[model samples]
Target: MADRELEEIGEDNTLLLVDDEEPFLKRLARAMEKRGFAVETAGSVAAGRAYATARPPAYAVVDLRLEDGSGLEVVETLRETRPDCRVVVLTGYGAIATAVAAVKIGAMDYLSKPADANDVTAALLAPAGDLPPPPENPMSADRVRWEHIQRVYELCDRNVSETARRLNMHRRTLQRILAKRSPR
Candidate 1:
């Protein structure tokens, strides 16, 4: 799949990434680079579109929301200009409606946020509509709860008090959860 897109653009190893979260962008960019993509990142739809116009990527991972505009705009632009490019849309606010809309607008896959490099890689490179194999060791309920708490905590702008308030949890308990490494 990548080879075919590569042939069209003649840009080996290039990928366009659009996301508003700086930490996630940095982490995923590094991961993708380690996996062999020469990642070019943008934090907004406008920046992504401009970059695509100048040098369209053979692959893209676009977040559903950005600071300046909808990630759908980036998807539309890629579909119009680089139809062969493989695109995966990731979102924190995952919904059936939005997922359907993303695919209808030209995204090859729609993934929920907190997706690891392995998940993104598989989605980008897998045959359309084919799901990856299930994890060998799925998380237990406790682990899942912990992860969700962490996500919400981060979303609350890392305010322990706010996170606790939102989760209806004690501040000290939330801090304890944050301090512990994730359980397998």
Candidate 2:
């Protein structure tokens, strides 16, 4: 499918790497270039947009937070200007809402931070090709939701009672949701 799309578009197979972390962006750019992908790097979302505007890449790896703005804006810009480019959001502060928001805004996938070369490769190339067979839990959306809730609950200092109240959910219901998918 990815091959067919590529052929139809006759576009150069390139990947755009965007992140505020200069070291990580440089490392990823070098790694992908070594792996045979044409890679471009931008240290800020604004820069990424400008770079991509001048020369659109085939795919993009976007960090959610940027020096000037959110990566969601980049996704929106790509969708508007370069509709064929697939974007995969890379985020350190990963959360259910953000992940869902990314997908909703046209990101192909969202991966947590500390992603290595392999993760970067997968994010860039998987939707095009080289995708593994679909796993049982392709996205683990429920797991993401659970983790997000736990993180939020912890931020409230294990105050499940207050967290539940804040979320406008019953304490018992929140407990059930957490319990149903508790990690071993």
Tens-digit lDDT track for model 2 on 1-184? 3454345334576788889998888888887666666788888878888877888887888999887888888788888879978788987667778989998888878787667776666665564554444433333566556667876786677888998987788999888886775432
Candidate 2 overall lDDT versus native: 0.76
lDDT of 1 at 72: 94
lDDT of 1: 0.85
Worst 10 residues of 1 by lDDT: 1-10
Best by lDDT: 1
Q: lDDT per residue, candidate 1, 1-184, as tens digits?
A: 3566444434466789999999999999998887778899999999999998889998999999787878999999998888988999998666677789999999998887678887887788787677767765555778768767876886797999999999999999989989999776
- Cα error of candidate 1 at position 2, Å: 15
Per-candidate TM equals 0.68, 0.65
Candidate 2 displacement at residue 88 in angstroms = 0.8
RMSD of each: 5.2, 6.7
